[model samples]
Target chain A: MECKLIRPADLDEALAAREQYTHDALPIAGGQSLLVMMRNRLVAPAALIDLEPIEALRGVEVSSAGISIGAMNTCRQLIASPVLGEEVGVLPVAARQVSSTAVRNLGTIGGNVCHNEPGADLPPALLALNARAAVRRRANAREVPLAEFFTGYFETVLEPDEILCRIDIEHPPAGAAGVYLKHAISPEDLAMVGVAAVVVPDGKQTGGVAEVRIGIGGAAPVPLRAARTEAALKGAVLDAETARAAGETAATEVDPPSDPHAGADYRRKMVSVFVRRALLQAARQIEENGHGAA
Target chain B: MALLELKVNGQEVRVEAPDTALLLDVLRERLALTGAKRGCETSHCGCCTVRVDGMAVHSCVVLAVRCEGKAIATVEGCGDGMELDRLQRLFLEHGAVQCGYCGPGMLMAAQALLEQNPAPTLDEVKKGLDGNLCRCTGYTPIFDAILAYGRGE
Candidate 1:
């Protein structure tokens, strides 16, 4: 399939190209996922609307509301940003744990989330942070919560003509800490099971959980929020007993698949282990830092 | 076909190929800069590693047209005539090369790492070179060579 590479100067030009070609034209942010799929003959678009040149879709903007990360920012760039590393440590921490440097240098967070790979590291972290994906269709734009974004394995709610322009991660609560833990066969390999936890300290009660969010990946058809587990941990005190109960609840709630790397049972077990560990670590961070957005 | 201008190895070169053509194919076939080997066309294997804008990337997946107006460095650009670069010399000295197939890509990856961090620790070097897999030499020699080079030995 012979394709024409079109570099759209801005978001308007990109949306125009999308409006013309619709599903026939595919947007290329980092081209990491799309190109691999193209090589496998999974998708052959008539044209590739290159999003790299669109300056509007390539930056990390930190404001009072939260961090608005341009979709085109590579994993390497995300990990290198001190601002992201400090405010939303789970994001940069997750970015650093992605594949090798070669892939990290070219793989964009948007591509990672849009690919919606079950084992990808970014989705769970983004989900834990309660991030919102900014999607644009021509002149209209909307923000979709990351928790509600993934519809299925390798599927998202984004329309064929819409572009995922940026990701907006709300600032962590004044006394919240987050951690992402992925159990993989190798450091560079896809996660067998991934868990991200964000814990907000309760100012009213000492060492009590004010708010807790848990996101799980590779344990289900899609990365999802652990609602039942979060509910179990919300009002509980930050202790081994509460975290253990939350972990067990998460293990029961998830639906893992048996694959060559690991069995469904093993993944379920790991989800519990990692979720417990993540909660403990987040609690430790809260205790050490004593609260304001680490 | 698109007329793409690539600044490869510090030289501006023009190539005419389909927009879908990969940077690896254009570099090896059209430009005849065969230093970046083509192995495991999927991004998993680092045999086709190249530096685009000073960052190591798997060139096989990188679109040729997307590489426009960017500095690309390959193993061919690592050293001058009759002079091996520090990494090349150190790899040779430390027996980091056995079959020599992964040498070019490994060199480019290492070069990018060294340029970024002049004195990377052992774990950092291993992480930097993690993308490039060498089935031979057990990776310890490769580590020794990179560490020795970093020490300016």
Candidate 2:
């Protein structure tokens, strides 16, 4: 059977097309992974709604509240945006490390998130930045916190009739530093363990952190925040011992899967190792810059 | 099948293809521009790399319909069609081609990189070609070729 192609001019029309097709059609953004999946027979859709022609899903907007990133913004565009560079520096850093130059040229943040691949680079960084996904369907709209967006392996909370339009991230706290670490055999491979840490310094105590947010990927069914680990590190002076203990706690929080790339035991160990390294790197960024200047 | 009007190698052309036809297929089979090799229909190998609007993308994963109204440059467009380009000459001088299967894709990728960064460090060259894999030349010669091109050798 031949698959139909629908190109919508605007977001509203895209949403309506999505509503009309529902499960029969899949919206293709960049088509980096979706087309590959179709070729491999992993998925067979009756139609594809091409999201490339919609201008509304294209640029970045900065406001006093935070940054609003368009869903169709390619990884190359994210890496080049000066606004993201100044406001949320870690996003650009993580964006640069996604796949390879060829894939980055066409891959978009919306497709990455909606695809919900376990080892994806963006979710952990976006989660640590406290990002929210703005989803719309016809006349209705809603925003889901990035933390609650992913449901399971290659699954998200997105509905068949809805479209992920934007990702909104609030400004980081003053004097906070963010760092993302990826462990993989090759640069192009999905991370064996991906860790992202955002550290906010406590103004009262030198070398003390008021709060810490840790987002982990490739260690569990979905990219998730290390809540218990974060609670343990809250208001604590960051030292090597504290960082090590936080890594241990973060590793305990995840249920990793075993695959040919990595065994379950190996992935768990890497989770511990990378989380500690990421925190130490983030703290070092604070020490070097004096406050949250990193 | 849909009629696709595309700009390729500095010319406008039209072809009738399936709506979901891959850019690699359209370029190689329909347009007869076989310079972009077909290897690993999956996006892993850069053998199918081509420049769309001056950016290198794995054509195997790109839909031909999506490329309408965009400028697509394949490896066939590398030279003036008579003589080898400077980058191609550098590849030969540096012994970058062994089996010669990955040559065209390498040239397109290197050309895109140089257009963006006229002078690239050795590490930058490696990262620029990370998508491409060459089992024959062990990659050192390819790297040497790109670096030499950057240095105007």
Candidate 3:
């Protein structure tokens, strides 16, 4: 049981408190998943350093550099933001598919990544978007690519004292189209298989893909980028045949575990199907949005 | 332990509770507001749903201390004495109540939905109430009641 709930007035105060109670206390934002764990006797910290009151780690920032999302920003906030809807619409689409309306109301993106649950909706989207995570401990701040942020299931490269401050994702080219496809057992269930794709056409070469990124979730120990699939799709003609081949390549990249909810083989098959669908949908979005689709 | 102050059902109240004390426990035991039931201590069941700053969240998983200075509303606050809110009246009129265990959470979910969206489509209402679960009524009556309430019927 947490004895003291420390509500720091600012980020500096929060960091100072975190330094003081590095091992004794746990920094809790939203307290959705952490509280559940506490109730189950999975974690019993001496104190809970509440991170909600820190203003610096809240809200969304859009600038020329791209979108810098503060760790405290809730899934609801992400879906409600107009700038995110216009620029990185796939993220909101993925956000909406998280647990439920009530959970989305309180769940934070930073907490989501920190919790690092398998089949989480945001990580795959973040990977496809080529986001960077800004982490801080004391006065030292470092930016880690989203691809390298997660080291294993329920693990990240973050040290105990380090806090994820913000996530930075580059704005896709004006006409770049992105899609997130998730397959879950039910509306409220964690995704059995999730795929995110972002496709940008080359301005110089006719019908050639300038950049293609594919991210998959629930098919491996950690959310992963479909590196082979991206390599196959990159510079290839943005067409149905190329998307199909990329999907096949994506299936080979993942090592899924057999579980009660879904078998490893079934997940691998869904990965190929979803990847193909996501690619086709993204390509269609590019055509509809008229983003250099020659 | 911390002295947490919150506005519940439009009344300002203070309670001494541990930092880890769940909002659901504080509400039911300390505050004596048992409208929010303890169905699944886990968030899977919305039997403990409440409004914190007008957003629907599972009170079971929320820390009572963390709700300080926020407007909290439970099923007890949904009605005034014996006078029912429009949605409550509609729920009865549409036969949405069954075993009645999930009534408070269902009503809270519905109220939160209608407050945000005055005229929600059936699909939208289903989406709004996705977090809540009801074993009885097959959910059709609840949906109909909420839809009827939205139509101002």
Candidate 4:
């Protein structure tokens, strides 16, 4: 069967096409992974709604509340975005590490989040930043937190009739530092275990963190926050011992899958190692820069 | 079928292809410009790498219809008609080609990188060509070629 291409001029037309096609169509953002999936015979949609023509789905905007990132902004755009570099620096850092240069040239943040592929680099960083997905239908819209976005492997909470318009992220707390660490055999391969840590220091107590958020990927069925680990480290002074304990606790929070790249036990072990490294590095970054600006 | 108006090698040409046809298929099959090789259709291999609007992208995963108005540059566009370009000459001098399967893609990827960064470090050169793999030369010669080109040698 020949698949059809539907190019909509605006968001309204896109939503209407999405509503009209529903399950028979799939929205292609960047087509980085979707086209490969189509070639592999994993998905065969009757129509592909091209989101490239919709101007509303393209740019990065900043308001008093936070940053609004359009769904169509490619990874290259994210890397070159000075606003993202100043506000959420970890996104550009992660964006640089997405895939090869060619793939990152066209791959997008919204597509990465919606694809929900295990071992992807964006989710952990986005999750740690507490990003929210802005989704729209024909006549309505809603926001889904990054934490609750992924349902399972290669799956998200996105409905057939809805299109993810943008991602919204509030500014990180003052004096907070974020770090993303990926454990992949090669630079281009997906991480065996990817860890992102955002640490906010306590102004009143020296060496103590007021709060800590840890987002992990490729370690479970879905990218998730280590809530138990976060709770354990809240208000605690960060040290080698404390970071080690936090890493151990995070390891207990996930059930990693075994595959050709790694065994379940190996991946579980890497989670602990990388989590500790990421947390310590983030702390060191704060010490060096006097803030989480990096 | 869709009628695509493309600017390839700075030439305005019209080609009719399937709505969902890949840019690689259109260039290789219909237009007969086979400089971009079809390696792993999955995009892991950069054999199908091309420049869309001056950005390096794997043509195998790009839809032909999507590239309608974009400037597409393949290996065929790298040099003057009858003579080898500087980068191609450097590749030969550096002995970068072994089996030559990855030659065109490497040239395209290298050309794109050089255009972006007139002078790229060895690490930057490696990262720029990370998507391409050459089972033959172990990449040392390719790296040497790009570095030499950056040095204006």
Best by lDDT: 4
> Each candidate's lDDT (Cα)?
0.90, 0.91, 0.87, 0.92
Colliding pairs, model 1 = none
Ten contiguous residues with the weakest lDDT in model 1 chain A:
A285-294
Sort by TM-score, best first: what order?
Answer: 4, 2, 1, 3
N/CA/C clash count, model 3: 1
Candidate 2 deviant stretches above 4 angstroms: none
Task: Report the Cα lDDT for residue B138, model 1.
Answer: 86
- When summed lDDT is taken over every stretch of 10 residues in candidate 2 chain A, the lowest stretch is A285-294
State TM-scores per candidate: 0.98, 0.99, 0.97, 0.99
Candidate 1 per-residue C-alpha lDDT over A1-294 given as tens digits, one digit per residue, 9 for 90 to 100: 588788788899999999999989888878887898989899888999999889888989999888999999999999999999888888888998898999999999999999998889999999999999999999799999998899998999988889999999888878889899989988898899989998999877666888899889999999999999998787789788888888899999899999999999999999999999999999988888787453
Candidate 4 per-residue lDDT, tens place, A39-75, comes to 9999999999999999999999999899999999999
**Candidate order by DockQ, highest to lowest?**
2, 4, 1, 3
lDDT of model 1, residue A46: 90
What alpha-carbon RMSD in Å does predicted model 4 have with respect to the real structure? Answer: 0.9
